[model samples]
Target: MISFFKKFEEEGILGINRRIGEYILPYNPREYYPLVDDKWKTAELARQFHVPMPYHYGLVNTFGGIRNTRELIKGRPGFVVKPANGGMGNGILVITGESEYDNGSIIFHKADEKKITEKELYHHVSGILSGLYSLDGNSDSCILQERLECHTFFREISFRGIPDIRVIVFLGYPVMAMLRLPTKESGGRANLHQGALGVGIDLRTGTLTHSVCNDKIIHLHPDTKRKLSGRVIPCWEIILQMASRCFDMSGLGYLGVDIVLDELRGPLLLEMNARPGLGIQIANRMGLLDRLRLVERIHDPADGPKDRVHRMLQEL
Candidate 1:
């Protein structure tokens, strides 16, 4: 048991203390946080930078604007309602389909076939505007984003919700990446703590190599029961390029870029995280310290996004 921990330490498994003391504290500045913290701001910045992302319907900023929900998302066949300041996938309501009832009310269905009324949907969005999901009880807004359809390849492995790729970028280079797949236990949300499966991806090959669920290594998905390893992620190079570009857009030295693959749209940037979690180490069964150190040693401060990605692929 001690040797197991010793090997982890020797391989540079980055602990929370080392992450903060070494990376977050020195590399990330407070001012750059807002770029990734607020969902709306992140969307706007991605638009300004020409980063591909899901189509945004509109924002519900005030109580009065809540009435515009129907009109805002009228033509959107499917949409995601989420708090602009929410984290860990909280307060996110995904409406996959809608139908009108005889009483003139609309019914929305979730991935699990759970049905909700339009009034219930309005109340959920109202809670978001009331700051129910915000980090510090600050006023929040509701963003209506286009729902993404998972690529056919992932649909076989995922139980319900769409899977997303998380690429950790350090010094403008993509150091590590993992595929976050939603599970029945996670309520179809791609969050590790919520019981989602975190599968490690080969940095150069884009193939699934390892997987973890509830901190235990697994070879098959609990719900889908499909083999989790050896599957190749679609749009692998494009996803890494998109993640590398986020460094310039957000100006954060250490960043986590979340991207999703839409069946028709290829890869789209979903969100960004300044303080990315450490579960990725468990998924990869390796420490992030070594990968991060490699980035620092090879990354050039003057390299552009394209040059940085090229250098990283060649050297790392």
Candidate 2:
């Protein structure tokens, strides 16, 4: 056990303290955090920058707004309710579908097959307004966004949820990427700690390379039992392009760009993170310190997204 741990240290596994102290603290400015921390603000910024994201119906910022949610989302076939200030995939409610009865009461179907009523939905939104799931336990805004249909490729590997790609971007260049796949254990949420699989992808080629679940290495998806490597991500270049552009949009030097592939829209920017986790190194079975240091050395002002991607590939 000691040798195994030593190997991890020798490989330079990035810890949270080092990540925050070295990369995040140095690159991310304090003033711009609200743009990414608050989902409502993030959506507004995306609109101004023409970055594609899930369509939001409206925001419920107060407890009173919760009472009006049913009318707001009434016509939608499916939707997601999330706290604008939430983190770690908490306080997110995905309503897959709904049914109305003769009494005018509606029943909503969750991804996990549990049923909820309109009143219950309102209550959940109220909880969000009270900051039950926010990062700092402060009053939060609740947003209802259009539910995304998973791309065909991920639908086969994921179980009852949409998976998203996480690309770690440094100084306008995408350095590392990973695909987060939801499993039954995550209750249909694509969160790593909730038991979703993290599959590493080649930065240039978007080819699957390695995977992990519950912090343990794995090669096959738990539910699909399919090999987790070699599959190419659809719209790979577009995904990286979106990630690269986020640097200018948010002004964060080092960031994580979360993107999802919509069946019709292709790749959409789900969100951006000022302090992205260091799990990509674990999933890729590599060290981020080296890649980060290497990226720091090669800074060319003339490089575009395509140029940066090509430069990395050429060096590889």
Give the Cα lDDT of each candidate: 0.91, 0.89
Task: Report the C-alpha lDDT of model 2 over 1-316, residue by residue, as the tens digit.
Answer: 9999787668977778888898899999999999999988999999998999999999989787777898889889899999999987998999999998999899999989999998899899999999899988998999999999988888778888999999998888888899999999998988998999999998878999999999999888999898979999988988988898898889998999999999989899989999898888888888787777777888676887777766655665
Number of the top lDDT candidate? 1
State the displacement of the C-alpha of residue 87, model 2, in Å, after optimal TM-score superposition: 0.8
lDDT accuracy of residue 256 in candidate 2: 94
List candidate 1 stretches off by more than 4 Å. 1-7
RMSD of each: 1.6, 1.7
Task: Give the per-residue lDDT of model 1 (tens digit) for 158-201.
Answer: 98899999999998899889999999998899989899999999
List the lowest-lDDT window of 10 residues for candidate 2.
307-316
* Deviation from native of the Cα of residue 4 in model 2, angstroms: 7.8
lDDT score, candidate 2, position 305: 72
Best by TM-score: 1
Off by over 4 Å in 2: 1-9
